[model samples]
Every structure is written in structure tokens, then in C-alpha cells.
Target: MTLPRMKLTDPKALRGYAHPLRMALLGLLRQQGPMTATRAAEQLGESVASCSFHLRQLAKYGLAERAPGADARERPWRATARATSWDDDSDDPQVRAATDELNAAQLALYTRQAEEFLARRIDEPTEWRAVTGFSDQSLYVTAEELAELTGRIDALLAEYDDRITDPSRRPDGFRRVSLIQLAVLSASPGGGPAPAASANPVEATPAAEPDAAR
Candidate 1:
């Protein structure tokens, strides 16, 4: 009810959540609704046993829980939160390390999803193709301004939280959209690689899908 977002601080909890399947499963449950392991396996093209095991693991870490109507023959699982939040700059070394691992895993998963979308981009409907593509922008702002900007973005996202949490409110043509926001403080000029020209841009290597499916 409080716009569920898990605020994780424990290194142990962070490490438990860094797994690819666990992250994906949480996303799926949040997007959809309560689902049995069999249903999740079917949607993900994975094994029911595997999903069941990971769902249990997620429950162990307080990321997920058994749904209210679940019974022995068909237990349903639901995400405890709509999203996860953590501070990247923790004072503890162990917390920082676990945060790094989770961040890296999320980045890898997102990159692979992006590559997969690109592979099928050409075949997508013309309207969607026209509206979808990468955009790059640079802005100079102070730390306070950056925090304010992120807060404004979160406020914007909150406007649509109801549509996400309640499937029935979704519009006819709308589908799930992933919004990724990455902000990094800039160093002095010449501190890092120079900006690329508009004509030619550096490309990142395509990421392979996580091994959790196997």
C-alpha cells in the first residue's frame, strides 16, 4: 500500500538477490500477478522445478511470499515489492561489494534484453519501430540538482504505478516498458574518453543471456 519498494541494506540480502532468475522472477510477479511456479516456467520457457526453487529462495530473502490462495498442489508466489532500492555508496566494504555484484548482474540482464529487442526490431510494426530507439543526452548539474531530477523522475513514474500494479487498468495497445535511468558524476574535462560525434558512436558488445534458463 505504501508504493512497495524494498529498501535493501544488508549484504546478505543483496547477495541473495543478485541471481538472474531471482531478479527476473521478481519482475515477472510484479508485472503480472500471483503465479504458480508452473505458470512462471511456462512464460519463461524454463523448468517448473527451477522456478519453484528460486521462488523459495526469494521468499527466504523476503523478496517474495506465498500468495493468499495458494494450496499444496499449486502454490502461488508474489513479489513483496514492486521495485528494489539500494544505495550504491555504502560505508561497509562488504555492502559495496554486494551492491556491485547486483548492479553488474542487472546491467548484464538489461543489455541482453536490449540486444534481443534489436535483433527483432526490424520486423516490429512500423509504428513501434518509429517510436523506439536509443537516445543520448548530456547535462551539467550539481549534486543537489541531480538528486532533485531523480526525485522528479520518480514522481513521474509514480503517476503510472497504478497502471502497473493493476493489470486491468492497462490500455488496449500498451505493453510493458522498461525505463532505465543511469546518472554518473562527471570528472574534469579530459578525465575520461571524449564525447563521440553524432555520425559514429561506439557500440557495446552484445550480452549473452544468463545461464539461469538452463
Candidate 2:
């Protein structure tokens, strides 16, 4: 099934969701399906109370909701959407500022994850090591072309969306992979002198979702 997506426009909701732990919790729910606060805390190494509180806050902002539980006393929460997005081009200053904060938090999360992978990369099996790690590239394209390129990438990743919710769909040796795509304008028209080249440069890959915060 195509996972539902949540688009945030309200400044209050954007600010509330711009927290590190909250983003982590939302990502956990999306990856593991519905889970109780205690279970989520165990996976994330956070205290049960802290996870519970943040889960409630996520629901308040419409990013998450209560799912059917094992019994009356059990409360399981699930992400309302597989992807969360926002308008980076909002005219409202409050919305823009809130999005900026959220973007910073998201970048921090990605950086930490990348660092963790690098710290243990040497120990990974040869095949895994060969396939893992990052690459980058500099592209020259029009704004419309960039949009088209990102859209195509999103479509390609959507082919595997079902595997996220169905464990049976994943084949043996399959594991989670994080793909971060960045395509920012490096320089403006007739700007400054060209920067020095790096000794080693990498290729670029587009991300799975457009305007997705998580």
C-alpha cells in the first residue's frame, strides 16, 4: 500500500515537531509499525516515561496516532504518515523560521547516523563495506530539471515502500539502508571565483521523498 503522508503548514505544529527525540520516535514508528512507549524506549535507549511523553506530543501535532492495542490497558502508537513534509517556501516568517529549526535538527540526525556507520564500517563484512558509504557530485541543471529529477527518484524508491511494513517481503540478508540526497545550488549566476577542487569527490543520489522531513 502507498503510505500516507503528512504535510505540516501550521507554525505551531512545525515547531513542536522540530525536536530530536520526537523525530527519532516518528522514524521508529514508521520503520517498526505500531509500538508501545516501553517497546519504543527499549529500541531507542530512552526512558519509558520520556518516550511516552514525546509520543503523546507527536499525536498532538497530527504526526502520530493511537493504534489498536493488545488489550484495553495497552496503548500502541504509530506514525500517522510514513513521510512528513512542509512548505519551505511559505510566505509566513514564523513558518519559515520553524522549518529552518526543523531542518537543522534533521541534518544533525543524519550526520550522527553517518558518523556511527563510519565508526564501525571497518568491521563490516567485505560485501557490506563495498556497498555502503556515501558519494557526492556537482550537477548543473535548471530548477525545473532538478524538480523532475527528484520526482523520478522518489518514484523509484516507492517500488520498495511495501517492504517497510511487511517483514515477509524482505529477502534474506536484507537490512535497512539510509539514503540522504542533497541537491543545492553551489553558486549563483556570475558569482565568485571557482573554489578549489577536492582530492577525492563522490557521486550523488537523489532521496526517496520530496520535501520530506523524516
Candidate 3:
């Protein structure tokens, strides 16, 4: 099946979609299908009123819409598309700025998810713990090569897209997984190592965990 997608070109729509909660709500609807504000609130641990407000905002930008409910008074919201996209290479300043904000919000979510998994991973199945963890690789490639690599990865992931919208297509042990891929330049252009650096540099220290859980 061809998955529906929402392509955001308007700066206003991009800005509106940049909120963390709104992004989370859209994700929930896409993964779990149609749901009322009350049900979405229960799943997201957010207020029903807040969910209602955000759902309306999403609808304004054509990201979501009201789905059929059991009765007239019961209204449910559904994501308009299974995937969202925007022009990362847009020359428009407003579009670029809005895209940056949206990217930051998305990265924050990914970081939180990784941290949460690390915090409770001990309780997970041994097989899962073995396979789930972070790894970074420094690749030496031209811009075109990098783009091709990412495209290949996207194509590989697309093989499983059908299972996302059709639960029956999933295997018995199937579970939801978030695979975050980031490819970017490692250093500034036309710049070399700092003069103060030693031949063998020490690894940077890791940041301390926050006192309170998010």
C-alpha cells in the first residue's frame, strides 16, 4: 500500500508543527489510529483540554482531521498522513528557520527516548537489551555519496512500512521500534585541528544525569 504523507512547504504550518506535544500527539494517532482527546490524553499523560486545543491546531495546518466516531457527540482525531516531510534545502529564510525549530524538537524527542530506554533497559528482555544501544560511526564520503547512503537506508526501512498500519501483517513477537538516523559533516569546512590540541586527545567526559526524571 502507498502510505499517505503530508509535505509541509508553508512556514506557518512548519512553525505550528514544531511543538513537542503536538508532534507526540501526531505520532500517537499514526501508530494507534483514531482517538478522542480524552483517550489521547490518557495515552500521552496530558490534559484532555490541552489535547483538544492541540488537535484543533493540527487540523488548522492540515496535519490532522476529525474521524468518524461511534456517535454524533463523540468526535475523534486522526492523522491526515502516515508520514510528514519538509524541504530541508529550502532557500526561503522563514522555511529554513521553521525547519530548524522542527528538527530541534524532533532531536529532543529522540534523545529523551534513548535516555529513557537506557534508564529502564535492565528490565527488558535480554534479547532486546542485547540489540538496543547507541553507536556512532565516522564516515568519509562525499555529499552525494552521503545522500545516496541515506536514501538506501530509507528504502530498506520502507520494506516494513506495511506492518505499521496493518497489525495483522506483523509477526507474533513484533514490537514498535524507533530508528533514528543522522548524517552530517563532522567538522567545519576549510578548517583543520586546533593548534593547542595534542597528538593524542582525551575523550570528552559524559554529562551527569539530571536529578529529576522527565
Badly placed stretches (over 4 Å) of model 2 are: 1-3, 190-212
TM-score of each: 0.83, 0.85, 0.86
Candidate 3, 57-96: lDDT as tens digits: 9999998899999999999998888788887899989899
Residue-by-residue lDDT tens digits, candidate 2, 106-194: 78767766776777778878766767667655666788998999999889988987777777999998756777776656667644555
lDDT of the candidates, in the order given = 0.73, 0.77, 0.75
Q: After superposition, how far is residue 56 of candidate 3 from its true place, in Å?
A: 0.8
Report the lDDT of model 3 for residue 2. Answer: 44
Residue 197 in model 3: lDDT = 32
Between prediction 1 and prediction 3, which has the larger lDDT? 3
lDDT for each residue of candidate 1 in 1-214, tens digit (9 for 90 to 100)? 5336678899998888888778778877876678999998987778999999999999998989988764567778887776787888789999999999988887777776677778987887776666665554577677789889989988987798778557788889984556555565558743455455343132222223211211
Q: After superposition, how far is residue 60 of candidate 1 from its true place, in Å?
A: 0.8
Clashing pairs in 3: none
Q: Once model 1 is optimally superposed onto the true structure by TM-score, how far is the C-alpha of residue 104 displaced, in angstroms?
A: 0.5
